[model samples]
Target: MEQNDHLGQARDVTEFPFGADFQSILSLIGDGVVSTDHTGRIILFNRAAEDIFGYTSDEVLGGSIDALVPTRFHDRHREDVDRFCSSNAPLRRFMGEGREVLGRRKNGEELSIEATLSRQMIGGQHIVTVVIRDVSARKTAERHRQLVASEVAHRLRNTMTVVNSIVTLSARRAASVIEFKEAVLGRFEAISRTNDALVSGSSTDVSFRLLLESELAPYRDDDSKITLTGPDIALDGQGAVALALVLHELATNAAKYGALSTSAGRLNVDWKVPVDAPPLLDVTWQERNGPLVAPPTRRGFGSELIARSLGVHGGTAISSYAASGVGCSIRLPLTGAPPLPQ
Candidate 1:
């Protein structure tokens, strides 16, 4: 994810810097230093090389340079080494051009690395020194960031499509322009609130209970009569957003004609996960103690959304206007495909 070529020259390992120790200086440098002969045999191995390649000096001192390179790149690595050794450049050649190199460790695991080669002609033998730094962690992190960016872009497009559908459906049910605008704005507000919660959450999956509570927050006094029960599991990103819209529609209808319209009304919402082989989420919405319930003569946008959204989410949604109250159940299969952004 990052590369740099700094200006500096390291002295020969055998040279004494103002009578200071020679090998001690090489051991103190942070980067791995490996010295190889013209035949591609490693003649010098520093402590950093051992730490990076997982080999002791005794094991790798005279080993082929290909020992550090992956098996697939062995041919190319040897050819490059030979070409560098035969080059008619200056006596000291400093190369710091960045490359995505890999090193093979003792355990056979490969890691990303950045290496700089220095070719020097000492006496009559040509020696090559390579400096290496491990970069696997940085690369992995960069890949994750890219994936997050791509996922965010796809989800934003999906959200806009859902918004367009909501606008069209809301317009169909309104008699006047003012009524149409109010219906659209209300649905948009519900969607906006869900998006806010999604941004505030630390993970992509949202807590089911928290989502429901936020949608039902408009009538805080109804909390005393409303009940919610089950293990609070999380929903995937699309599932969370779609369910928020579904719950908002149900609550709006309830305030107009169902349980929430009367003072004595009560509502019970619960969920169950069966002991079957592949357990699924079974959520129920029931209301009672309100005005007499009647089935809708015509399907509205609210009804269509509640009835069809779960099906798109790899699940089912069904409702009944029984003599006592209105009841609905949504079944979401956990092992199946995740909810689509429909």
Candidate 2:
């Protein structure tokens, strides 16, 4: 080891024994290699170190190693270095295995890095070497994984809440145990179908046409009885789930009492995207050729579910009991919908 006192008076490593081999070895190291004296002054700044810290070897040779560390860690860094140098242990020690430290580049950008420290007594001179590797990419990937996990947990909670509400409402509306069982099982099946559509697509949102098609699948045997008219619009998570529940309730009621209850009855569903700021989708559900309709004396679970679902998104569902049949006019705010010529 070449003995040099203080900064700026640092000597070229080539002047020391096997100095050429020492310099050659430092150049070939893939990770940043920084050697400092007992005083924490840098003595050897390698090529990899120059690339990692965004500094030329000449620029940092006589500088304090603290320059590479973020200001927040300066105190801890100094304490750790001092303790390591004072200890009698001669073996190398790994630093920041799972916990990483921040490294400051020449451009002032911060990086996540892991470091390994080793001390050697060469010719009675204590030389401390630190090998650093950039781990910013790994840290970023870990954070992304955590975020996805959190989102999945949140979605699962919301799904459970919706299922519980369905159970409570189904029991409240049914007169017999068989009726309750059918209602609950049917609604659960609808949710499962909706989830299937959600995952089948590559996108997070589902197509408006697809959402409606899934609920109206059983009635599609007679195309003349079911007329669906609208440009395909995509619905986000909240919108997709809300509209699915609303559609299932409407279809159920129609099958039990309205259009789908009679062969002569017909169901027509049409929607249009109106040209307006904060776009809106105007939909009409009209039943024709069924028994004369009359408003119910009391609202049922279906009515309550439709109203609540639409209300969450500042939308409205108005049921009309015309003598011809049952009809509903729904107005909903649609986000990120492409405006089509109406």
Candidate 3:
């Protein structure tokens, strides 16, 4: 067994023998602990080092440290090691300094790592020890967090744009300040309900059924008066918010003058998206058992908002006040719907 001493000289180290007990203690450590002499030849490769780099202690003994580092970093690594050995700095860090720490594996793959280096005199010889930790999982988690944050920011910006459009158009159509305030507040409430549904879901956006149910939740009771029937359909950020406002207006109209206004009244909301290159949402808002209906003498701002809320690219809305009931059939080009699950 080799010995080390206070003077750091091989011959003088007889006072401190390197034994199996010392090696076993190092092997128990979680981080890879690698030690090298003045020549950068690895003298001790602990079990954790073998697990990290896929190299056995016998295979890496007396080997240069470069074998464990990426090719691009070999030169800098050697230079830094030389500096550390010559300087009085007791310890050094070589990861997370606006630079990545990489380690090469026996299979030629490079892995992310963090390491701390320290130098000491043992029996008159310079010895360098490094404590290395694998950081790949941490790096992956950080990237995922960044992606989620960016997605949330993007959705918030789109929501603000939708709100701005609603306020601007409502203000232009209002005859009085009170009308403008009520219109804007109602639309904002719809958006708030939609966002609440989104918070309950695991994804960044909510499903179409969830958004619809949220808008009509106030009236739903043991009667199952408010029902949603459609395939599970995911809506993108903007689509969810826009559709929520439209549904809220429909429910408001129903509660005030349509089926929801009477105990015996019934409302049926059914939607379908036919298979096409770009699918279209066919939504039917039918009211039954309500007061005799007649076409409105003048179109209201609420009706106008429902037509304009979905945007102007391609959409159709037709409302009829029949003798039996009041209803609307809307065909909207569904854009930004999520892909079907695998």
Candidate 4:
């Protein structure tokens, strides 16, 4: 009887110091902890486990651990447990390993979790402990990042397509070394201006007003040759670049052989957004007081550039000669325009 009392006193002393300590450790853990016996019956549910699965220790302790596993995985999980128990070998611990698994909550909702499994021996009986962390938020963030990357790549490819067309058309028109160099430089300048506008807005869409002013800067002087008349409109990057190249070609042609070549010649530019029908931008460029004008016997670089650029966005340009002067009208589908700035 005396020896029995001594053993009981020893047990009480050991348990007293560890009761609060073990509880504190479990409470401090960030991941859910679930312990089950070799038979797969739950034996311990830590504070984090309760929060994660919406189950109290008392409610889960004597229940099957399979309750916390997704229904689809329960059969395979059972077989794994049986295999481990029969082999008398501990399954590999998964701490710090990024393994994805499905975990079930009290309401039967399945959550994606990263988990670590470990084995412990207590009183000659083997127990398995699982530590689970919810990874749903991380997975969602990764998906969003991937979507943004894909959109950026697609926009870049579209931008390069416009750049390629501009370079090809400009290179074909150069008759002399000096002319080729000037043409290439001119095209590069136009692309730089468009890129600057896009960067300023931090978006693919650019302001139509900005694009026109930038393209006409080189030709604008004391003479009031370039004019704008329209409510402000926005153009997506691809549309803006195409339009810039079209205007450059027109201005270049006029300077070399058309209206802008003479002292009295001037170009009138105007545009409007109609409320009725699908959105349209009607731009008219009329040359006055220039030398006698006639359509080219063969299509030139300027003509091809204008046609191809407009065609990129399903648009067309019509050039006509009236008794007054040569008039060029461009009609573009405004589908490429950006939403009005708030």
Candidate 5:
């Protein structure tokens, strides 16, 4: 009786519809597994499929596979099913291999998915199995990477253009090879320092005080020699870059012929924002206790650079020659600064 009972149990296991362990294996899979019969009715909906589609196996089994497809893709899904039924393609093929496909959950939320389809003839009936993995996170990450790449490219082009202008302008004004080399190297160093500060902080704006200190740090002997008085002001990227060039030119001139060249000299920078309509920043630069100053015979690259530094931003710079030293006044529109003329 025991042998007969064992034989009957084995026969029951063999006659099971899903084979001895097919359903058990499907339950352990991480990716969703779904199979449909020739009539497009879902036949096998595994545990993973239930989780992915937000449906229970009992709710999806024996229903049309269209239940899991988004409305926009229903017609295409049916065409693909018809092709599989007719064996128009290979027996097994991957879907959405290089691109994301759409899937609709039970709650009508659309999601990105990657799927693989396998066609088989089981007991003279056409069966199609699909293995699906959600790829919404991966798609989002890819788009983010593309945007960063495009932004980097734009910034690099702008930087290279500025460098080219510096090289060409420096060469035009240089008196000799040595002068050209010195001018180009000094300007490059100033730009590099500004870039360093810009990247050190998470914000795109740079402090006006920071830009001044970077250019004047080498010449400053003590607090008495160099004075900077102004409220904290932030400059946008283009503003920072333009102001850096202007500051470098002024510091270079002072070091060669003006206040910074003398030990007893003093340099003062003061700026104020008055209650004027549409806010303006008024900055004054004064020098004292240096050799008697006189205007240049003709305006040079330094003067031209200072005048145009705020380029198309509606700012102005003016210089005055005093018996004591050199003085400059600059006015910059703090609000409603316009874009550069294209």
Candidate 6:
């Protein structure tokens, strides 16, 4: 009798501490924790499990764990429980173990959940413990990040379109060895600037007034030769780059053979965005008081650059050789700027 009494005391001491440890560990978990018997009946539901599934522990303790599973999974879940009970196979019980599943809330709203399940023997019976966490917010954030990355990539491609045009046209216009070298060098420099801007992941749209001033800076030595007037508007990276190259090519030509070739010439640039046109931006470049004006007998680099830039957006340009001066009018559809690197 004494030996049996001592053995009983030892068992009680071991079991009591073990139960306390198990409860302590379960209480610390943030996710829902549930234990089911070999017959798939719930035996334990932690406080977090009650909060997560919107069921009181008393209501779930003697019920089937299937109450938390979606109706669509009921049949397969029974098969799985049977297999697990028979084989006592080790089931994964961590974040990456189970296929993504939906858990139904008490309010009938469905939530995306990740589950980890494990099996153990308790009181001579096999039981399954499941830990579940809601992953909806994490999934949402991942999708949002992917969408932003895709948009940025699309914008960068659009910006490249303008860069490609500038390089092609500028290289084609080089007649003299020196002229060709300068054009190639200028194209490279422009591409470098574009790459620098893209690295920041900023939206590619830039203030139009700022772009114009920056592009026209090369001609600032004779600041009196050029005049600019316009309200500040933003252009997408592609539009800004295209317009900048067009202006650069025009300025280069004028300095070599057009208005800027002589002291008596001046260039005027102006823009207007009318509300009736919604998003359309209208701009004009006018050359005045230059030497005798005449259209090039053959289409040159300046002509090609302007035509291609406008052509991409179904735009139109009219170059006129009036008695007073040469005037070029370009009309482009002002669609919201294409995605491109800032």
Per-residue accuracy of model 2 over 1-342 as CA lDDT, tens digit each:
243354534443322755678889889999998888777778888898888899998887777888898988899999988878886457598886667688999988999888889987654566798899988899999998897677567657766877888888889999999999988887877777777776686555677778788898887778898899988877766677778888898888888888888899899999888766568778899988877788999999889878877897899999999989889998889877553223
Q: How far off is residue 151 in model 6, in Å?
A: 5.4
Where is model 4 more than 4 Å wrong at Cα? 1-19, 29-89, 92-171, 220-225, 254-269, 272-275, 279-294, 322-327, 334-338
Q: What is the TM-score of each candidate against the true structure?
A: 0.83, 0.73, 0.70, 0.62, 0.67, 0.64
Ranking, TM-score, top scorer first:
1, 2, 3, 5, 6, 4
lDDT of each residue in 87-106, candidate 4, tens digit only? 44567566334556778999
State each candidate's clash count. 0, 0, 8, 0, 0, 2
Q: Which stretches of candidate 3 lie over 4 Å from their true place?
A: 1-22, 35-43, 51-93, 103-111, 117-129, 174-182, 221-224, 279-282, 292-300, 312-342
For model 5 the local lDDT of residue 268 reads 95
For residues 209-267, could you state the per-residue lDDT of candidate 6 as single tens digits? 66566666766667688898877766665665566666666666767767777788888
Clashing pairs in 4: none
**Lowest lDDT 10-residue stretch of candidate 6:** 6-15
- Give the per-residue lDDT of model 5 (tens digit) for 1-342: 764464344334323666748878888999998887777777788899888889998787667899999998898889988887796343888885676688999999988888989988665567788999988889889898887677557656766777888888889999999999999999889888887877785555677788899999999878899999987677666667777887898889989999999999999999777765567767788988887798899989888777766664577888889989888887777643332222
Please give the lDDT score for candidate 1. Answer: 0.75
Rank ordering of all candidates by lDDT, starting from the highest? 2, 5, 3, 1, 4, 6
Candidate lDDT scores, in order, read 0.75, 0.81, 0.78, 0.75, 0.80, 0.70
Candidate 1: which pairs clash?
none
Q: What does candidate 1 score on TM? A: 0.83
* Model 3 Cα lDDT, one tens digit per residue, 1-342: 233241244222322676677878988999999888777777778899999999998788767888999899888888888878885546556644678889999999898898988787776678788999988889889998998899779879878877887888888889999978987897899998888877677776677777777777777764556556667677766677768878887888888888888777788888888776478777888888977777888988668777776765367678888988888887777666654463
